[model samples]
Each structure stands twice: as structure tokens, then as C-alpha cells.
Target: MRVQALIFDVFGTCVDWRRSVAREVAKVLPQVDALAFATAWRAEYDPAMARIRGGERGYVALDDLHRENLQRVAAEFSVSAPERLAHAWERLDPWPDVVAGLTALKARHVIAPCSNGSIALMTRLAKHAALPWDCILGAEIAQDYKPKPQVYLASCAALRLATDQVMMVAAHNDDLFAARYAGLKTAFVARPTEHGPHQTTDLGPESDWDVIASDFHDLATQLTP
Candidate 1:
């Protein structure tokens, strides 16, 4: 496919955001259902970004959106939201295969995150998860969010690669759809439990993606030279 770079959807595809955030939520809001709380907070994510994507608001970093959502969820749960809790997004843990898989991919092609996360958030999360990233590219670079053509195209531009020369690796069919529409290659990595044990969405590939793998380890074997 002439792929020179692999851009990833970081939150669920690389890291287990639901569990990682729930762990932190449990520590801070012990009285509430942490998993439920984490899920609730995350549920606010797309709607919040939609404001910007739809031009109802100017662009802001994902950190700000996270903080805003945390406040609302905390109030809904009748707990005082700790200011520091906003930083929890920066402390996500990667899936078990992520580190080794990304390391292998890095050996051959450039690897970076094409996430909705701001560069600062992505950088800190990379450090926390020990992800081997070649660079950070995504919403911050395009001043927009994912599912938007600009976000995917800008990420490829940042790497100085043509759309076809880059592959967007994501677990979500919608994400891959957007990336493909932007002219980049697509890879679907099944993260069946990204939303936890009973996760219903993105359990498998929904299209004829360029590559499909069971996990990052499998993805590395398929994509890495």
C-alpha cells in the first residue's frame, strides 16, 4: 500500500481509556460508581467537541473539554470535582500489546498519534504509557477534531507524506471511515473491550479496511517490514 507512516487513534485503540480513567476516578470519587462515572464523563466528549466542530465555539484543547465535562459529571454525581482530576486524561494506560507493538512498528515506519487529544495531553499520555511515538499530530495541528477530513489530512501533511502513503489505525469504524474519506489508508484493530467487558461498539472491522488485526502485536506483524 506504499504506507510510510502509521497514525493512530490513541484513546481506545492504543490505551484502555475506560479502565485507566475509571481507576483514577475511583481514587478521587470513591463514593460513586467509578466506571459509570468515567463512562458518563466520556459520554460528554463528542457532544462537547461537536460544539467546536459545528462552529458553535472556537477550538479549544481536549484538556479544557475534559475539565468541563468532569465538572458536569461531578455535579451530576453530587461530588466535588477535584481540579487535579482534569489531568487524569494525561495518565492513561496503554493496552498490553501497545508498547511492544508500537516499538516494532517504529523500527520500520514513522508512528504518531492522530487523536483528538491535544499535543500536551498526548505527550503526557505517551510518557505515562511508555508509548514510542515519532511525533504528535491531530486536532491541535488542524485546529479541529477527528471525523473531520482536515484532522486526518493535516496529520499526514505534518509528516510530509501523501494521504495514501499513511495509514490510519483505529478501532472505530467511524474513525476509519473519516480517514479513508481523507484519502489515507486504513487499518482496523479490534479492541472489543475498549469500553469495558460489555462493550458493544467497534468490536470488529465493519469494512474492507486495508489491514485488520486482533491486536497491536498482530498489527505489527502485518504492517512492519
Candidate 2:
């Protein structure tokens, strides 16, 4: 397969959102269950995006959605300072192999993030995590979220490349499923620890992805120039 670019699914794929957000939660809500709070807050993400994707609401930046969700969960957890806590997402740390792996992958293919995050959120996260990306792509570009064909196609359009020439690299089977439907090449990088030690799903590849890698470094090695 001829591939010229590799677009990543940031959140859990590159940065360990679960742990990073949990760490932040512990700082602000010491008496709360940090991991559980993080999980509850994130659980609100998809349903919130579905509102926009289904046309119930217009496009809202991921950061704003995050803040909204933070407030909702903060109330449930009886936590204060929801605004400051929401900003924690901007400072997520990348998985150990991400920076080095993407650096190597960038040697051959243009690298970017095709995430649901807004450009500002993606940029801050990239800088905080030290990810080497050529550009940011995803929902903000399409004004829609993943699983929506427009999101994937829009990113490909932004790069002026055919969908088939750009591979969607992600850890979730559902994400790969959507990208494959959009006519993009697909690669799955197993991130068993993405959701934490108890992650029951996405522990391994669920389909015949073009490449099934154990980590980003392995993916960089598998991609042909």
C-alpha cells in the first residue's frame, strides 16, 4: 500500500489521558476517587459529541466540551474549581514510546493528529507532550467528530491527498472501522494500558488492519516509505 501520511488518534493512543487526568484530579479533589472521576468525566465526551454529530447542536470546540463535561462531573463528585481542573487535559503527558516513535515515523511520512480535539487543545497537548507533528487534523477541521466520514475526509482534503494515501493510525477498533469506511488505510497500535491496567477492550487488534503494532515504535518500523 502506498502511504504518504500518518494521522494519529491522540487522546489514548499517544497521550495517556486516563493517568494524566487522574493525576490532575488527585491534586484538586484529593478526597475524590481520581481515576473514577477521570473516567466519569471522559464518559460524557462521546455522548456530548454525538449531539453535534447528529445535528442537535452546532460545532463546539473540544476544549469547551471538556469544560462542560468537567462541570457536569464536578457537580456529581462535589468538586470545586471545575474551570482549572478542565485545563488539566491540555497538559497530558505522552506515552513513553510516542515522541521517539513519531519522530522516527516523521522521517518518512508526514505526521499529524486526527483527533476530536480543537486546534488549541491539540496544540497545547502536543507541546506539553513533546509530540512531533507536521500539523493538526480532525473534528475541528470537519466541524464533526470521528465515525463521521467528513472528519476523516476533511483531514485528507486539507493535506491535498487521496484518502487511500493517508493511513489512520489508532488504538481503537471502532476508529479504524470508521477510517476504513472512509477509504483510508488503517493501522492499529495496541495500547492496552491506555485505559489503565484494567482495560478489558482494545487490548489487541480486532481486525486485519494494514499494520498491527504493539506500540508506536513498532508502527514506525512497519510503515514503508
Candidate 3:
């Protein structure tokens, strides 16, 4: 089936969150290990969302989760000014190939983010990173997070497309696994440095996804005209 839309996983795949967040952290907590701080903060993301997914907590925007997680991680490191640091997620930088690739891909298909990030967060980050997104979709719209059937189905419904007509692109194997289960075609764009130098997960495509590309630029070559 032809892929009419490509819904991206933004945080790590479209943007270099680790390095960018670490850099931002360095500015605020000059004494802390910026890279480790960034890693620690991200480590809490899934667990935070899991609470909501499991019905232990209610749905909240990524910003709220990030802010709450920042406070906890900051206390762990005894870092001051956690409030300022929480905004780092908004200022993340895009991967080098992202702009060109998204532009190329957008010419051929509708391109949007199906990330866990909120619409406001995604909008600000997109502006900060100069990302070209057609629309923002995902947790905010679904009132639920990814790896859940509702999130993927909500995105497909919003775009007025069938599940098979859309492709979910991500660097995370787990995310793609769920998307595939939701009946969306999957694309794995390897983001080896997403978690920094020693990252082990998502080093390559973990399963036989519908498409696997080295990066968004390569994805453009394979999926875009």
C-alpha cells in the first residue's frame, strides 16, 4: 500500500535530544555531568508515561512529565534552578539531515510528528529546530501515549487515512513494534547517537520493519520522490 503520510518520532529520531539537552543542562548546571544528567532525565520518561498508560495516573502533556521528571533528577544531582532546566526540551536541536530530509519527504508525502511530545512542545521545538512538520499528532491528540493502540489509531483517524496508508517512523524498536501492531507500516531510521556514544539500543533495525534507512536523508531517498 502507498504511504500517504509519514508520522515521525521526534525526540530522539528527528532531534538530537541527548546532546542538545546535555548542552542545555551544561548552561544551567555547570558543575553537574551534563551528559549523565541528560541521560538520567530521559531514563524517567517511559516510566512516567507508563504510570498513565497503566491507569495509575491520568494523561498529561510531555511538558508536565518532563518538568516533574526534571525536579526529581535535579534533586538526585542536587542541581539548582531545575525550573529553568526543564525548558531544555523545548530548545532541542534537530539532527543535521532533518531539515533537508523532511523538506524532501514532505514534497512527496504528508509529514508530521506522532511523538509523545505535546502540540505546544512540538510546535516550539519545531520552530527552534527549524523543522518542517505538516501537523502535530500523538499523545496530545490521543490523550494517551505510544505503544498503545489508541495513539496510532488516533493519528490515522485525524489524517483521514487508513492504518495501512500511513507509516510510523522511529528510531525506537519498541515504538515501531507497537505501530506495526496497530497496522501502520513501520520505518526504522537508525539514530545511533540518540542516547549518546555508548548507546546500545536502536543501533540498527531490530526487526524486519517495512523500511530501514540510515537517516532521514536516506529515508527520503527510499520513500520520497
RMSD of each: 0.8, 1.0, 1.0
Could you tell me how far off, in angstroms, the CA of residue 141 lies in candidate 1 after the best superposition? 0.5
lDDT of 3: 0.92
lDDT of 1 by residue, 65-115 (tens): 999999999999999989899999999999999999999999989999999
Q: What is the lDDT of residue 31 in candidate 1?
A: 98
Tens-digit lDDT track for model 3 on 1-225?
A: 699999999989899999999999999789999999999999999999999999998998989999999989988998665586788999999999999999999997999999999999999999999998999999899999988889999999999999999999999999999999999999999988787788888898889999999888899999854
Worst 10 residues of 3 by lDDT: 78-87
Task: Give TM-scores for every candidate, taking all chains together and pairing residue i with residue i.
Answer: 0.98, 0.97, 0.97
Off by over 4 Å in 1: none
Model 2, 1-225: lDDT tens digits are 579999989989998899999999999789999999999999999999999999999999989999999989988988675587888989899989999999999998999999999999999898998998999999899999988999999999999999999999999999999999999999998888877788899888888998999888889888744
Return the top candidate by lDDT: 1
Better-scoring candidate (lDDT), 1 or 3: 1
Clashing pairs in 1: none
